[model samples]
Every structure is written in structure tokens, then in C-alpha cells.
Target: MQRYFIAPEQFGQHTVTITGEDAHHLLKVMRMKAGDEIMVCDGLGRSVLARLTSLEAKSAEADIIAEMETNGEPMWKVTVAQSLPKGDKLETVIQKCTEIGAAAFVPFQSERSIVQYDGKKEEKRQQRWAKIAKEAAEQAHRSIIPEVSQVMSWKQLLLRMAEFDLVLFCYEKEGAAEGSGIADVLAAFRNTHDSSREAAILLVVGPEGGFTVHEADEALAGGARLAGLGPRILRTETAAMVGLTCLMYESKEMGGA
Candidate 1:
């Protein structure tokens, strides 16, 4: 069965409505007709098995047969704070991390970051990143679509740190240091996880040359724990994916292995 992510408002009693691009895909591209079975998901973690019943020029309606279980959401929520890397690297980061169960992606400014954005470009880039996340989520069968936030300044990143239960700064300089290893931090989280409460984590990754010493100091002062990926260094795009992969693998609901 084919799958489509529909807006929450479109899901009504006994029937599901699909419009816009998705509808066009079904109507023309996929050529789906009445009686076709399709899996539909509301971005808010609700999925249903629906059968196509009617279609207009660019919209399709389906009858809700049964609601499907939403098991694609991770037990732990992770927000990846990525310093904007050069070229289309940010797209790769958002796509891969979304598939890895990252709840959101935040692009920020860093001392060593080479790429810069402003005005129209910034808005357009964010939109592109969002679209990438949506496609990735649909492909991964995720219940929730990860968000891609606007680029933030250093001050903004600091302010956002307080909102999360845990903040991990992917510091390459954190070598064999106490409380600075990713494994140590993850172990602590796994051991202390109380099912009753939700865990919101922020994973910060630096750009090409990585964070300057001053940035590292500021992050620490702002409540971020420096954590190393491993002995070998990873690129700006690769770091966040590693962080998300580890988080997903350790969480019970996200196919922990």
C-alpha cells in the first residue's frame, strides 16, 4: 500500500482528505483510483489504513478502515543544533538525522563556520531544509515530521540550551576527558531514564574547522556538556547523524540495539 502524510485538519470522522502535492501525486502520478488501499499518517503521530473512495480534480478522499499504531516516534526527543556547513551539507544533515529519529534541526552561527545566510536566502534555505525533512520522514515512516529551525546566532543558541533536559556539544577536543565522552553521556541517560517523564536532548555540532576554543568555553558556560564522537574526526554533516544514530539505538521504542 502507498503512504501519504496528511494534515491533521484533513483527517475527519470516518474519512480522510488529502490535497495539494500529495493529492496530485495520487491523482495523476500514481493514478490511484477508488478502492485503492493506502496508509495515511497525520504528522502528529496518528496513522490510519484508509481506502480511496472518491476524487476531485486535485484532491482525494478516503474512508478510514482502521487506525494504525504509531511506533515510529523515538522514546527520546533530540534536537540537532548544527552550525551551517558549506554548500548543501545542511540538507544532508537534516535528511539523514530525520531518518535517524531526530525531532528537530537547528542551524546556528559558529566562529569557524564558512557559510553565511541572510534575508531571502535564509528563509529559502530553511524552507528547503524543511522539505528535505518531510520527504525523509515519509520515507522513514516517521510519525512526527522533524522541524528545521531558522539559523541562530551564538547568543540565541545559548538561550535555547536551557529549554532542553540535556545539551551535548560534539567537541572534537573532548578526548578521553572526564564526562566528555559520548558513550558516558548516553550511558548516564539510559541508566537514569524514567519512563514517566519525557527526555528532550540537544546535540550541537560545529562546522568544517569545528568550534573555536572560545565557542567551546561559552557552550560549557551555557550548560552544554562537551562530548566526543570518537577517535577519528567526523565532518560537520556527519557528526549530528552519529549523535542521532546513537540516541535512536539506545532508546527502547526506536528499535534499540
Candidate 2:
């Protein structure tokens, strides 16, 4: 069945209202009629099997049948803080990371970032990134869409590090002796936090040129732990996805008993 995410307010005691683009997609694109069944999610981790009760040109309604058990969310909330890369790499990062179970995405400017931030096009770019995340989430069958934050400056990103319980700064220079292994860091974090509560983690990935020595020092000073993805160097767009996949596998979100 096709899945649609509706606002919590749109859901009543036993029915859900679909409007806007979603309604158009259902009525016109999907050609869904009354009594057709589909899956509905509140985008707040709640999902239900719903049957179409009414259909209109610009709106639709569905009756909730049964609640669904969705385990698509990861135990840890991993936020990808990626420095802007060239072209549409950021879009690829957001889309892939969302599918890999990233809780949110943060685009920031770094010292080595090839692509400069454009404030005039911020709103348009953010909207595009957000749409990518939503579509990826829907395709991945995620209960909630990952959030895409406004592009931040290096200073802003440093300050924002305080909000996370753990921040893994992906530095290319980080080697076996100097850098912390991802598995070890995550294991320690899991041991410290309560199993029942989701832990907030910030995975920082630099741009195409990667982070400068000064920037890495500043990140360490800002409470981020230097971590290496592996021996091989990864591109800016690939780093977030690899980091998130490691996290999900470590947390057994990928599959475990």
C-alpha cells in the first residue's frame, strides 16, 4: 500500500484528512477511489492502516483501521553536519543519509569548503533539501522525515556542538594512533546512556577539500571527538552516509536479535 504522512492535527479519533500535494497525488496521480486502502503516518512515529472514506479534487479522507508497529527509527538520533560541497552533493547526502536512518541534517560552511554559502538562495535551497529528505523517508518507510537545517557558519556549527551528547568529527588526518575508532566511541556512548532513551549524536563531515588543521583543532576545542571512518579517505558526500551506516549497524538498527 502507498504510504502518506499527514499532520497530527489532520488525524482525528478514527480518521485522517489528506490535503495539498498529497491529496492531489492520491486523487489524480494514484487515481485512488473511496474504499481504497493505504498506510498513513502522523510523522511523529505513529502509523496506521487506513481506508479511503472520501475523495475530492483537492482533498481526501481516510478511516483509520489498525495501528502499525514501525521500527524504522534508530535507537540513536544521528545528525549529519556536512560542510557544503560542490554541485548537488548536499542533496545526495541528505537523501542517502535519510534512507540510512539519519535523524537530521545540518549544512555548514567550513574553511576548506569549495562552495560558498549563498544567503539569497537559502530558503530555496533549504526547501529543496527538505523535499529530498521527505521523499527519501517515504521511500525508506521511515516513520518521520529527517529535518534539514539552515546552512550554518563554522562558528555557528562549533557552538551548536554543545547540544549533542557526542560529536564525531570526521578528519582525514585521524589515524590509528591519533584518532578514535568509530566502534569504540559508539560502544562507550551506548554504555553510558540509558538504553530506553535515544542519544543525540552529531556526525561532522567536512567539504571536498576536508577540514584544515586549524578547523580540526577548533572542533576538538568545541567538545567534538576526532574519529576516522576508515583508513581510506572518503568524499564529503560519502562521509555522512558511511558514518550513519556505521552508527546504525552498531546500534543494531540494521538488523540484530
Candidate 3:
């Protein structure tokens, strides 16, 4: 069945209104009629099995039949703090990470980062990323679209790192040299989290040039664990995806049982 995400404001009583692009897609593209069955998400982990109540060219209403909690979300809230990479890599990173269950994304500027974010570029980039995340979330059957935060400086990044209960950095230089691999770090984190308790994990990935020794040291000192993704070096976007995959598998798949 096709699924659509609606804001909390769109939901009320026993029905929900899907407007804007969603209405057009359902009416024009999907050709769904008033009696057609569809799934609607509240973008807050609630999925409702809804039956179309009315349909028009630009708007549609659906009567929610049954409401259920989304169980696909990972037990741990994984946030990815990625340094802005060059070109369109950031979009790919955001889309794939959202599909893989990243709860939020923070694009930060680091010393070696090639793409500098001034006011104008940052706003444009965030808007673009938000659209990408929304589409990806729908495609991946996710209930909520991960938020793309405003651009932050390296100093601001450190300050936000304090919020997470656990943070892991895929420092290719350090983790590859040392014996601590990503899998090991994930295992350790998984052991610490109890299924009955709420926990959050933050993973930081640097851009093409990767995090410098000085930046890595600062992160390590600020409580982010340095871990390796494996022997082969991965691109900035690839590193984030791999780290998130490992984390989701461990924390959600295995930890749940």
C-alpha cells in the first residue's frame, strides 16, 4: 500500500487531511478514489490505516481506520554529524542515512572541509536536504522524516556533542591504526543500552580529506569515541552510511531480541 506522511496539525478527530503535493499525487498520479485504501503517517511514529473519504485535483481527505505505532524505527536515536562534503555528496548522505534510520543530521564545518557554508548557501542547502529527506523517508516506509539542522562551526559541533549519551567518530587515521574497529565500538554501545531504557547514539563523519589530527584529538577529548569503519578507506558519504548500518543492525536488530 502507498504511504504518506502528514504533519500533526493535519490530523484531528478520527480523520486527517493531506494537502499540497500529497493531495495532487494521490489524485492525479496514484488515481486513488474516495474508497481506496492508503496508509498515512503522522511524522511522529504513528501510522494509520486510512480509507480515502474524498478526493479532488488538489486536495484529499482520508478517514483513519486503525492507528498503530511504528515498530521499524531503531531502538537507539542515531544522529549523524557530518562535515560538509564537496558537490552533491551531502544530498546523497542525507537521503541514504534517512532511509537507514538516522534520527537527525547536523552538517558542520571543519578545518579540512572543502565546502564552506556561508549564510546564503547554508539556507539553500538545508531546504534542499529537507526535500530529499522527505522523499527518501516515504520511499523507505519511514514514519518520520529526519531533520536537517542548520550549519554549525566546529566549536558549535563540540558543544552539541555533549547532549548525546554516546558519540562515535569514524576517524579513519586513528581507528585504522589502532585495533578499535566500528563493529567493536558498536558492540560495546549495544551492551550498554537496555531495551527497557531510552538511549541515543551520535556518529560523526568527516569529509573527503577527513578529520585532521587536531580535530580528532578535540573530538576524542570531548567524549566522541574514535572508531574505524574497516581496512579500506570510505568516502565521506559512504562512511556515514556504513557506520549507521552497523549501528542500526546492532542496536535495533540484535538488541531488540
Candidate 4:
């Protein structure tokens, strides 16, 4: 069944109003008519099986059939703090990482970042990124949409390190002796923290040219643990997804019983 995310206010005790692009997609794109069954999510980790009650030119209504049980989300809330990469690579990262169960994304300008932040177009760019996340979430059958934050500076990102329980800094220059492998670091974190509680984790990936030695030093000083993905050096766009996949696997959200 096709899924559509609806705002909380639009969802009532036993009915949901679908408007905007979602309404258009259902009415025209999908050619869905009244009485058709579909899935509706509140984007707050609640979903329902709903049957269309009314269809209009610009809006649609559905009667809630039953609450759904969705387990697509990861137990840990992993946010990707990615340094802005050149071109549309950030978009690729947002789309793929969201599918891989990223809770949120924070794009920051690193010292080696080639793409300069454009304040004039920031809102437009954020909207685009958010749309990508929403679509990916719906496709992946996620209960909640991942958040895409406004671009931040390296200093600002470092300051926000205190917000998470663990910050995994993906540094290419980090030697095997200097940094713990992702699995080891995650194991340590899991052992220390309460497994039943949802932990906030930040996975930081640098830009194409990677982070400068000084920047890495500052992050380490700010309590971020240096973590290596593996022996191979991944591209900036690949690092976040790889790191997140490793996290999910280690956390038993992927392959474990």
C-alpha cells in the first residue's frame, strides 16, 4: 500500500485529511478513488490503515481502518552531521541515509568544504532536502520522517557535540592505534548506556577533501570519539551511509535476533 504522511492536526479520531501534493498524488498521479485503502502516518511514529471516504480536486479524506504496527525505525536515534560536499552529493546523502534509518541530518561547513554556504538560497535548499527525506521515509515504510537541519559552521557543529550521547567522528587520517573501529566504539557505548533507552548518536563525516588535522583535533577535544569505518577510505558521500549501516548492524537493528 502507498503511504502518505499527514500532520497531527489533519488526523482526527477516525479520519484523516490529505491535502497539498499528497492529495494530488493520490487523486491524479495514483488515480486513487473513494474506498481505496492506503496507509497514513502522523510522522510522529503512528500509522493507520485508512480507506478513502472522499476525493476532490485538491483534497481527499480517509476513514481510519486500523492502527498499524511499524518497526522500520532504529532503536537508536543516529543523526548524520555531514560536512557540505560539492554539487548535489548532499542530496544523495540525505536520501540514502534517511533510507538507512538516520534520525536527522546536520549539514556543516568544514574547513575543507568546497561548497560555500548561500544564505539567500538556504530555505529553498532545506525544503528540497526535506522533501527528499520525506519521500525516502515513505518508501522505506518509516513511521517518522527524518529532519534536515539548516547548514551550520564547523564551530557551531562542534559546540552541538554536547547534545548527543556519543559523537563518532569519521576521520580518514585517524590511524588504527589512534581511533577505535566503529564496532568497538559502538560496543563500548552499548555496554555503558541502558539498552532499553534510546541513545542519541552523532556520526560526523567530513567533506570530499576530508577534515584538516586541526579540525579533527578540535573535535576530539570536544569529547567526540574518533572512529574509523574500515581499512578502505570511503568518499564523503559514502561515509555516512556506511557508518550508519555499521551502527544498525552492531545495534542488532539489522541482522541480529
Ranking by lDDT: 4, 2, 3, 1
Inter-residue clash pairs, candidate 4 = none
- Candidate 2: give the clashing pairs: none
Which candidate number has the best TM-score? 4
Residue 246 lDDT, candidate 1, scale 0-100: 75
**Candidate 3 structure quality by residue, lDDT tens digits, 1-257:** 89898898889789989998899999999988989999898777888999999988777888889987687677789999999999899899999999898899999999999887789676777789988988889898998889999988999999888899888988887556656898787778767767677678889999899989999899999999999988898989999999999888777554556
The residue-by-residue lDDT of candidate 2 on 24-134, one tens digit each, is 999999999999999999888999999999998789999999999998898899999999999999999999999999999989999888888888999999889988988
Q: Model 1, range 78-152, lDDT digits (tens) per residue?
A: 999999899889899999998888999889988888887677687777778878988899898888888888889
User: Clashing residue pairs in candidate 3, if any?
Assistant: none
Q: Can you tell me which runs of candidate 2 are displaced by over 4 Å?
A: 175-179
Query: In angstroms, how far off is 92's CA in candidate 1?
Result: 0.7
What would the TM-score be for candidate 4 when compared with the true structure? 0.96
Candidate 4 regions off by >4 Å? 175-179
Q: What total of clashing residue pairs does each candidate reach? A: 0, 0, 0, 0
Q: Which candidate number maximizes lDDT? A: 4
Q: What local lDDT does model 3 show for residue 174?
A: 56
What Cα-based lDDT does every candidate model obtain?
Answer: 0.86, 0.89, 0.87, 0.92
Better lDDT candidate (2, 3) = 2
Better of 1 and 4 by TM-score: 4
